[model samples]
Target: MKFLGSLYRFSSSWVGTICIVLFIILFVAQAFVIPSGSMRVTLLEGDFLFVKKFSYGIPTPHIPFIEVPVAPDSDGDGHLFQGKRPQRGDIVVFRYPKDEKIHYVKRNFAVGGDEVIFDLDNFYLRPNEGDEFIEQNYDKSDIVILNGQKYVKEPYKFKGINYNPHFRNAMRASMLGNLERKSLAMRPIMVAESEKVYEYGSVKFNAFYIKVPQDEFFMIGDNRNNSGDSRYWGTVPYRLIVGKPWFTYFSIDPDKKIRWERIGRFIDTLQSDESLIYEQK
Candidate 1:
């Protein structure tokens, strides 16, 4: 009884409180804020959410704000305790591969061994499971034959996944420029030998293709056209994956108006509820 009382007193102390909070932030959940419209409708700018740190296992703990790793990547996999990889279609928060100091959130479009194709606007995926799995799993209308292989059109089927028809290649020049420099992982290839080249502004290119490297994931933002993602950079390796979003603790619009309806909502609820989906004007 005496020992229990002393332990309680210690826990209530300021130093103990700080330690407890740090423990939660490091291994349980960490606070994250949406800084861009890349996740749009699903996760908006100014939305403050908790990232479930252990969702994919215990990643190398970083000191918040400073973003310094608590320990070196001992295993080189970035996890102190190895965990399962993020599943296809999961919304993930990961450290940007190019700059580990930055964090990026996007949907896991395809996993290792899968193939991806991005045209001017359309996104197609060929899962590693092969054609039979594609035929059995996806709607017939969503399936398309590309170069003798079966690919699914817009396979994610999420309400927030937007393909704004009016939004043209805002990045056509830059994208084509990246292609020229071989900076982008995807390569431009004609869907067919005689297929006419598609033009955006003065830049012209056919569709792009990439095979997700082993133990890596291809990520794409829900706001398709405007997102700077795997299609522009490359697949994200397992080492950089952080965690999944937990729930929105607070949300405010650009004008600083509180989003009363969004607060306290779980990310799963926000993502799956079509009524909450923003209809592009």
Candidate 2:
């Protein structure tokens, strides 16, 4: 009885409180806010969410603002405890490769060893056949037989994925682009590791065929044409993966309007049911 009392007193002290909070933030959950439209129609801008850090693995905790590692990665993969890697079609949060200091969130479009081909806005994915699930359940319309192999289209099957073709590459000419070149008005371009030849939209564009490197993943935004993702920045290494968005504790609109329906909602719950999130007005 005396030992239990002492232990309780220690846990309630400031040092113990700090350790407990830090452990939750580092290993269990971390807060992340959506700052861009890249994941729009699924995860909107201003959605304040918590990332379940352990969804992938328990990574070495960094001192929050400074981003300095608190300890060395014993597993050599930045994770303190080895866990499952992000699977296809999961919304992943990770440190951006070009700038490890910054965090980025994007859907896992393709994982290591997969081949991705794109012509303008349309996509063709040739997943590594090693994943039997892809060979078994991938949509029929998207699959094409070529030289005794099969390829899938818009391969990521996340229901909220925006495949609306009418949304044009006009953004490269307007707000999204800062350059003053003719290519700005042309179709979207993806400079993949490998190149395929194709033309679209009278722009005579060269297609991109990327082979995702081992231990890396190719990320794409659900808002396809509008996002600057793997097409521009390249694939993400597993070492940089942080976690998956767990829930939206709070959400707001550009005009500071409170989104009542979205408050305290889980991302997976919203994704599973389409009819709930649309504006009632």
Candidate 2, residues 1-281, lDDT tens digits: the string is 99999888888999889988998997899888999877877888888999999998787788887899989977668788868988888999999988887889998978888877665556777878644656687867777643345667777655667744444555323312422333221234434432554444354335555788998898888877677788767899889999999999999999999888888889897666676445211
Query: Residues 54-78, candidate 1, lDDT per residue (tens digit)?
Result: 9898999999988999988867999
Candidate 1 ranges beyond 4 A from true positions: 1-3, 193-196, 199-205
User: lDDT (CA) for every model shown?
Assistant: 0.87, 0.75
Off by over 4 Å in 2: 74-76, 130-135, 146-148, 163-167, 171-206, 279-281
Candidate maximizing lDDT: 1
All candidates' TM-scores?
A: 0.93, 0.82
Residue 113 miss distance in model 2 (angstroms): 1.1
Model 1: clashing residue pairs? Answer: none
